[model samples]
Target chain A: MKTSDFIERLAEALDAESSELEGETILDTLEGWDSLGHLATIAMVDELFGKTVSAMSLRRCRTVAELMDLACGEVTP
Target chain B: MGRVLEAQGASVTAVAGYVPQGRLCNEELSSRYPEWSAEDILRKTGIRTRAIAAPDECASDLAFEAAKKLINREDIDPEDVDLLIFCTQSPDYFLPTTSCILQERLGLSTQSMAFDLPLGCSGWVYGLSVARALLEAGEATTALLLTGDTYTRYVLPEDRNVAAIFGEAGAATLITKRSDLPGHGAIGPFVFGTDGTGAEALIVRGGASRHPQKRRRLEMDGPRIFEFCLRRIPGLVHALLEKAELDLDDVDLWVFHQANRFMLDRLRKKTGIREERFAWRLEEEGNTVSSTIPLTLESAVVSGQLKPGMRVGVVGFGVGYSWGAGLIEWTHGGMQ
Candidate 1:
């Protein structure tokens, strides 16, 4: 799935509105986005792409776009 | 107490149950209990294998899974739950209460009533009674009934008395307004009674005014507890059936708290109820304290044995010499 589509799905999984998960919204800036949500996001990423994303890899992504880039294998950091 | 809730238009929007992942299957437990193989032990205890919560996992964790499953299914809005009753003896915190934490995690409204009932075995039935009453009294439109107990937290693993019996799990049900559904009935009269006098029969030596957590370890009088259960449960069930205007013959299914296979089988023989009437998951779930009844019922529904419109009698009896019985008029069919 596309990065935007992935972000939309993540928003739904987190029970947050799609608009709230748009680009430039730093992952840490989102309310109710806690450790559990972080773990869930990683799991969702693995489920969508038949591969594992390391916690170290997830930490490099500051925003949803960056996370999507990492998930798409377009960006290593 | 026995009006048909489903007949009044109420619907069960969701049902969920959870068992921890650290498995103690029949093969493993039988190795520890030499006289009994896992199968024999299951035959005796009505449990083949049981899931044990990790040291860090608490009752709240199991309840969280149940709530999460229900919410993920999008069957009912968390805010729609007006009452959240966590029936468990093992609360995550000694002071704050497990139900309160679940309320926050589930994002239930502050207006909801949240409380933890520190009871064992019969807790699910007691909770269902409370939920039904709340709905009937118009105290709330829907109630979330959750039961869980991490008993291993209180028991010594080496204590053969409880080790062979207790396991960990959680079960949840969304009880909504009563409606006139083909297979559902209002909650039945709950025949509940407690014999606090025999509290020590199956209790932790520590963790109360008497034993405080600092001194915590399970100290059970197994023989005495077995004797007490045998004597008390049948009479209790009889009383409950009479009160509910039901006879043993009228019950299409009997869902008993899986205290042990021996106790349940004996109860079945004594009650003159056929083996088919009982839903046995002991070989799979063991004695999950408060969650057993609901979990067994859920398992039966999921496995397709319990059909819709079946009149199921639920009996919970254990610790504190506490016991309760309730009738669940199946309004819906198999769990899809």
Candidate 2:
């Protein structure tokens, strides 16, 4: 999936705005950045990229860029 | 369901489940966590009230209650019970196997073979698989497969993560070696899968040799488990159908483990199994680990949802990343 598409899907997953969820956006500041949000993100990334992200990695991600990088790395690797 | 089966051994003739008297209704949960309402619990999990075992109640207590009920209700002589298998992640003690205690308490003959199986949601089918193999091998004619777990014992009452999802219960399933006219509830055509790599996905880290210092509390990653179920269960269903040489429509009832209502509904749509064909009646008992499948069967039997001459597809998945599936013909009509 393209970065832009991934951003939109991730926004939907986090229940945030696509425009607001830029690469630099702090994921913790989002309204849906909680346990359920982690679940949604995990599901969305696995569904879209065919990669399973460990919960620990998601917990470690500080920004949208890092999360995206993790998914991209998993998918590309 | 219409296909005739060859004479089979080890048919399940009776099933009974027992839940402790304690109750943890959703109202209480909503009171504790304002964000979660009673309606939300019912809507999200399809659980109204969860059965909790009292502090004094252990897994064996629940198992004994159910086993006694099945024995009396079905007029099964304890001596006739030649094989007793208890499946549980929670045992009365670490030294003596709980199955041995159950055998003596239930008045089964000392000669009766008794043992314990350590598994969670994947337990019932595994127990049935072993019982079927043993019975077919002429090791025993009567087999009683009992499953009981007090998961709530370890789950922190305040930890909504797992407390809300688990309930305590025990169940007894009687698998007798019989080939009378090749009728329903005949047990066979089994498929098993396991992945020890995902052992940490759903686990209790405190009790065993690895983490003796920590308390035996259940910790789970909901998303990981959800992904596992969504991705693997469809393959499991397909594999079972292929082994049985039947399609989804041939199944009279589809009873997956009563993990939760959401997962069951999602799997139903994902697998394209119709609504009426699936069973999701865990409104009272949340998730009883190994006992979920058999408890569901007992409930179905009482409600008349499960009748004789029906081909039922049963799958028990979770914990150990382990799973077992099989297509069985129901033959418990006369006993009920």
Candidate 3:
């Protein structure tokens, strides 16, 4: 999947506007960045990337770029 | 001492399930938890109503009802059943074992073999394997595999996560020596797996000896459990197909544990099984733990979705984080 698509999905999962998110955006600061968001992110990654991002690795990601890195196996261009 | 590698000739002769009279519909649940609307619950979980057990009912009671119905419907004499296997996580008693009680309650002969196999979710498949093993070993001929769980008993009213997903039910399956037919139905070439590491993902961590006095209600990590399913199910399905030497296209039906509609849809898409081939019956009865597969199998048969000679791929996953998959050659006519 495209990096842009991934970002858009991450924004959707977090219930934020795509324009409001960037690689540096902090995850927990978002209103919807709770367990449901976490689950949605996992499901989105699995569906889009056909890969399971390690939940542990996912939790350690504090920013958008870090999540993209883990989910995409390094941020896609 | 003698044992044979070939599983003895066995076929599922009858299957029946019973759900208690009580029902907790999505409307009622949403009224209680205003944060979730009835539409959202049904749209997300594919479950609109959940069967709840009566306050005084036990898993054994549910199992007995199902078993009695099966025995009468199949016209099998209780004395003819030489082996009885009751699979449940909620047994009537931890001491005497629930199967012993069932053997008497169901009126099997005193000489019959009876025992409890405490398992959840993956239990019916596991129970089938055990009964087939015993029958093949000549330890028992006609066998009864009973799966019942009142998991609602473990659900606390406050926890909507599990309460929204689980339903109380029981199923009875009769396994007997295949009659003299050239192409008789068979259940086997099974693939089973267990990951104890995932135990905490869905558990009631309080009542056991380790924390006997702490009595905590059932709690589930939805994300964690869903992740586990996402990771493992594809492999399990592939392995079972390989073991059976059948291609995915050869399977006439796919009946996975009715975890929920969302998970089933994901698994179907991930595994590439056709939507028409998949059994999606959880809308009316939420996840019924061990009874889900048998109950769904029977439902399919009664509705004519399953027929004689059809190859049905069945798998059960959850609870202990245990899973098993196998192919069943459907034989019962009218599947009645």
Candidate 4:
């Protein structure tokens, strides 16, 4: 998936408008980025990529770009 | 060692379920968790209300009530029951196994065998499989399979992930042997899987041998559980269908453990099964741990969705990170 498309999907998963998200946006500062949002991201990643992403790994990501990198890394292999 | 005699066939004749009078609706939950609306909770979990056990109520108490209803409904004599299998994760006491307490409280014969099987979620199907084995072995003629848990008691009110999802309930099922030979609907070909590695994913880390003083509430990793279900259930169902020598279309109904609406829907889609063939009755009762499958079965029977002679595939998975599935040709008698 393209980096731009990943940002849009993450915004949708977090219930935020895509315009509000940027590659450098810190995930912790995002609205609706609570435990439920964490679950939604995991579901979205698995559904879209058929790859299992651990919540703990997502928790460690510093920015939207980092989250996208983690997802894309799994998809690559 | 020369000849092997065929064991008698066994099948469940009746199922009864009971949830306590108290209920926690999504509207109530919504007020507590402002971020999630009632519609959100309902949409995600397919649960509008969850039954809560009364303050003084215990797992055995709920089991007893369900057993009484089953006995009265089926006109079964308590004294005639040969074996009692009580499945639960929550017990009334640590000693004097809860099943033994049930035998005394329910007034079953002293000669009857009674024991507790400590399991959650995957328990009902596991209990059903055990009951069928005993009946087929001629060790028991009539068995009372009781599964109940007050998981609400273990979960802290503030824990949104598990608190809103689990409810308190109990179920009683009667499994009996028949003289007829086994055929299409006789219970067998059970497929079971367990992964102890994921045990910590859904657990109460207190009050057990290793952490007696911990006294912590229930903790769950929602993402991990969802991933586990997504990876495991579809394959489990297909394996069970193959083991039973039946195709997806041959099964009349599929009653999966009522975990959550989203997960169940995902499994249905992944398995390529139509919505109508799957059972999704957790709208009011929430996920009652081990009682889910039997509760769904009871509801299906009442609504005329499930009928005698129809092939039903029952699968239960969760908590022990354990899972079991079986195909039953719905029959009051074992087989014809």
User: Chain A TM-scores, one per candidate?
Assistant: 0.81, 0.92, 0.86, 0.92
How large a fraction of the reference contact set does each model reproduce? Answer: 0.00, 0.21, 0.39, 0.29
Model 3 docking category: acceptable
Lowest summed lDDT over 10 consecutive residues: which window, candidate 3 chain A? Answer: A31-40
- Per-residue CA lDDT of model 4 for B207-229, tens digit only, reads 88989998868998877787788
lDDT at position B108, candidate 1: 94
lDDT at position B1, candidate 3: 46
Report the lDDT tens digits of candidate 3 across residue range B1-336: 443334458888788999889998999999888877798678767899999889899999999999999998889999999999999988887689999999999899987899988878888888998888888777877899998888888888888878788998989999987756546788787999999998988888888878899866898887787788889998999999898888999999999999888777887889999988987679888999999999998889888898888998889898778998988788877744
Model 3 pairs whose backbones collide: none
Listed per model in order, the count of residue pairs whose N, CA or C atoms clash below 3 Å is 31, 6, 0, 1
Ranking by lDDT: 4, 3, 2, 1
Candidate 1 lDDT by residue in tens digits, B1-336: 532433243444457788888777767766775644565455445666678988888888898888788676656678888799999888887889889999999999888989998888878888888887777666778788888888877676576557777789988888887554534655676788888878877777666776455667767665455556656677887897888777888888999888777556656765667887888777666788888887887788888778777788888888888888877777655454
Off by over 4 Å in 4: A2-5, B1-6, B180-184, B332-336
The residue ranges of model 1 lying beyond 4 angstroms of the native Cα positions read A1-77, B1-13, B30-40, B180-183
What shift in Å separates residue B26 of candidate 3 from its native position after superposition? 1.6
For each candidate, what is the lDDT?
A: 0.74, 0.84, 0.85, 0.86
Interface root mean square deviation of every model, in Å?
21.6, 3.2, 1.9, 2.0
RMSD of each: 23.0, 5.1, 2.9, 3.4
CAPRI quality level assigned to candidate 2 from its DockQ score: acceptable
Tell me the lDDT of model 1 at A39.
45
lDDT for residue B91 in candidate 2, whole number 0-100 = 96
